[model samples]
Target chain A: MAGYPQNPSGYNYGAPPPSQQYYSAPYGVAPPPYGQHQQLPYTHVASPYGAPSPSPSYGAPSSSPFAALLPSTFPPGTDPNVIACFQMADLDGSGAIDDNELQRSLSAYNQSFSIRTVRLLMYLFTNTNTRKIGPKEFTQVFYSLQNWRGNFEKFDRDRSGRIDASELREALLSLGFSVSPFVLDLLVLKFDKTGGMNKAIEYDHFIECCLIVKGLTEKFKEKDTTYSGYATFSYEAFMLTVLPLLIA
Target chain B: MAGYPQNPSGYNYGAPPPSQQYYSAPYGVAPPPYGQHQQLPYTHVASPYGAPSPSPSYGAPSSSPFAALLPSTFPPGTDPNVIACFQMADLDGSGAIDDNELQRSLSAYNQSFSIRTVRLLMYLFTNTNTRKIGPKEFTQVFYSLQNWRGNFEKFDRDRSGRIDASELREALLSLGFSVSPFVLDLLVLKFDKTGGMNKAIEYDHFIECCLIVKGLTEKFKEKDTTYSGYATFSYEAFMLTVLPLLIA
Candidate 1:
């Protein structure tokens, strides 16, 4: 409530403390501070004296002032290396990368993705304005990518450099996907091309699986064109209607 | 960048504009304003002028300013209805409800959940201090329930008061669960006791499935003790080890 004691009975309500209420207005814009000396992290220790080049690439030396202050990896601050990656990926020179462009570029780096998955990836990784991922959004992408890679490696418990079916399921589960064991098997079978049942999911396969599952769920819903809150599927009907999509 | 224009080359950067750089200290605390007249929505009309009773309950008239401001429903904002529910459910009067208490209360509302599922629900629904959920969290619970209910109704396309297999799949997908068809079928089969393949899932069953899928994923992960990213199970093994847990 507006006037209740901010803290009552040892509960810390979300409302700002009364002393700091003046500036904590809901949706109110706050000003910036420019008084502090710039601190460059090891990953962002590029020369600050160089002039901006005509075609600046990631990690390329540039004197954009902003480039010099980008932090390295850990804190995921504005790092020049990642900013350059974004700029390079913005192939249309629109100053913002749409989902398609980002996806294609990421695929080049072995992170293949379905469009919906890419959209989810965008939602998870970037802070977009009107779905347009600009430089600011790309900084978050760097951080998110670092996180995704870490998760991938950690879950690849066998150290096989690839996650097999069970591991992929765990990864999806941790990512908040409430997948079933049978579905997990189907996913691995669909994507895992190795001859034996021991087929595994590489990084690209893992990303693809995440997206395909999302896509298939929507596809399944579409079959319920009657809006009956229920749809009947016999064995023949499933083999005809759904099997191709999964294999495809 | 430390002092560059917030927007350059038509690209919006996250840095604050130079105009307000002095006041916008990074992570500076702001203050609140009390001068504005309260603009209560049609939903926030409260029955004021009532005195607080010794044992106040949700939606019950009370003199507490916060209670007076809580809304009945719709546009969920600090509604006393949910707060009262949380209070009524807080059996020990500890000023905070743990997962067990909340689960028991939710079960009374027909939203039964496993301990693991309840923990996930708590994570999704409340802001806790050392996992103790207080009134502030109950408000969030109201909001989350409202959201879940909305998602449920939306996917129950036929208005049949229940969701079928495909519909359930869509509902789960919308609920951020990338479920598989096989799993979807199993869920419906588990909940829809009225035999025949065209089983439907009511609200309670749907929530249970969401929790079950999550719980099962955790259980499956536990079986992968070797970190091999692969677990072996014969049909007999599955029947003995997994099916019973699911039915239970």
Candidate 2:
């Protein structure tokens, strides 16, 4: 918990305070680094960012990192987006998603997500989808996980729960990250990884990847930022990085 | 073992005795029961009254009473026939089949099978498709189960692994069967629901449904036919009677 950034509102670590509301902006504009991002005009969506989110009043109220990342037109609970993902997950549409389905969804989204990873997740959520889910519907897994953990103890491999340079490396590798020399070095020194190969951070590795990516998100927020009992996060970055972790 | 019809040759139930290889006269004009009464060509399939079978093989090694009632083409492992079923069951063409699949296949073949019945059968063979089932596969789940005391003791509610009149009735009702008196009486008297619902019998019910009513493959064979120990079968009657039990 000490590594967590401070958030007065007590929402997700590194996340913005609850007061900030994103007005709908255009989507697909410059898009992200991937393929061409769609450009959505305010006319296409309902009040853009003003659209209702899936979660209730946000409880104590905290803006989403993903919603914060995309333009306002991209509302939090976009029906069409969810529908497509569900279709991918429920190939036969038998009212529930199964292991093969989750695998298909993962492959559809990121070729990197292996069948093993999807299978593990499926076992974790087997028979739970009495209600149908699309590949996108799986987002709940990641979002809930990150928002829920709030600290590194659970995922940290070395048991120290703190991300050191080498520990972060192994953890990232397990999660399907490509470690470049400079990127590894940056993450290493900053992440406090140097513990050893046998030791590694678990979920913290994933969180580290998402939150502190810099211009992308708040990289190194855990270390550089003071411990406010919560990790600091940017809306835009969390959505792209952390949120995608849950998708099949 | 009293019920286990002695499979002397061990040719799945009473498949042709691999050794003796008795020969028989081919067919002349068979009766209207197997032919004029069905969707497919009537040939080697054994008729209820021992109508002259088309195949040179006499008796056609019928497994159950209901078997006598099916079209000849639906014998064990028929190519085009099973291929159609596979298409239906393997919804995604990923090579494996699951529950809802067998359900649709049975329903399409006859009026007897229902969704609940299909689910029970699918669940019985839950893991078989993954492993290449052969000699060991033969007795492991099937014959071996006849002696199974553990599973029967487990799912058995009132210390009776076997469901009796009241238990079967309740089981059917729970599975979603209305338990019509005519069917209820018929079930109590014949289907031996009185015995414990051990995994073997469960497998038996599934195999019987697929081989008899649904016009699917007939790989499941009786141990033997003679008093020595062979399973009696009914390939003709629709399995809707069992659907209630499955739902329950």
Candidate 3:
């Protein structure tokens, strides 16, 4: 409750008008507010390397950065839409994508995630044994990306397409995380593209930061079974548990 | 503080007498109270399968369950005493021990850890990629086992060679884990070998149970960075995070 939005109505920044009957429809099948397959103006930075790029053309032929790297066909049972999204990311056509490919894919979506973020994503969703992010893992990652995008828009109340430190805190709070000021500063420092001038997080970095925090927190919870704030660990256990997430 | 021992003086159940200055000495080099290698009376069960066994002979030629399995020599810089201990556990001389070997080794120390506990140990200290527990990993584990053994002895207030539910609660509390009644009961049910009649945890089982709790808690703390007692995780992240520790 402490992290809940203070004004519920004010929180619905991007909610469709009550007249839009399909606003509440299931994801992946809902029609866009704009015309189907209509490309929006790419206002956001499309690459972490400071490049302007074309927006993604959903429900259309693949024109992603990695389009040339996609396989001709996807594995059985992969949803057609999901296969389309996966192809945009699976840059090597191995039916899997690594961190570099994922970065390019996100850039194609006009979301500029850092290499570190994509590595963390690979660490989280890829097969641990093979370090591969196949179509199934891609689907989950895409869904989370969209979910985080929605939350980001909702929290970016000014429609500036970015959230400053305070807005970021509110966003995390709404997501059930009440971080300390120290941790908040750390998050902002880690994700803020403004070089500490504005302490702001862009749409892509917000998703990256949130996923990192969530993944790390979930890993920690596995050890804190009694919900005790304190936990004991051998030196090796401590290193093994933390180093992978930070260094992966 | 809720978990702190009620009577501080009473908590030192197995402390050496005041005349014994080396009681506070560093581990691995200190002489045992009985003798440098005196075999203590084998009072506790040595095997999970109810097999009575000979006590381990320290500071002497190896006659352990896995003595025939030890390598002729150890890796360089391995502490002589530590090597002695490792040899006792490194059954099959692969220079590395798996969960089964670890279980046998703990049993040699008169500590009958369950295969599950040893598996968790491997999961925690072994090389994550190789899943192998080598000498270095074994050293850390051995140290932790000794530490836990000390704590277990301190909390076994009745000196009945086992701690009941109340004593276990005190043990965990002193170790900074104030588990809820439900968690405490669950722990007792899982670790208590008396089939839930007396709800007592033996020395070895206590060590195993405590390690499991500690490892899991440490892992959870990674994700709960905000310390909000809550975390958000994607479905795959949740499964990947929790499943290995539970099933490994």
Question: Which tens-of-lDDT digit does each residue in B152-226 have in candidate 2?
Answer: 344456663354434433333222122223333333333343332432233234233222221111111111122
Error of 2 at B133 (Å): 29
Candidate 3 is scored at a TM of 0.37
B170-191 in candidate 1: lDDT tens per residue?
Answer: 5554443434455565566656
Model 1: DockQ score: 0.01
Best by lDDT: 3
All candidates in order of TM-score, best leading: 3, 1, 2
TM-score per prediction, in order, is 0.28, 0.21, 0.37
Query: TM-score of chain B only, all predictions?
Result: 0.45, 0.26, 0.65
**lDDT per residue as tens, model 3, A1-248:** 22325443233222222231212212122322444222222111111111111122221223356744764333345457767877767767776787678788787755577665676677766524224576545765666666567768888888988887668766654553434444455566655666567778788778766766566554554554444333444333443454355334
Instruction: Provide the lowest-lDDT 10-residue window in model 1 chain A.
Output: A41-50
Residue B131 error, candidate 2, Å: 24
Better of 1 and 2 by TM-score: 1
Q: Which candidate leads the pack in TM-score?
A: 3
Taking the candidates in order, what DockQ does each have? 0.01, 0.01, 0.02
Q: List the candidate numbers ranked by DockQ, top first.
A: 3, 1, 2
Candidate 3 residue-wise lDDT at A52: 16
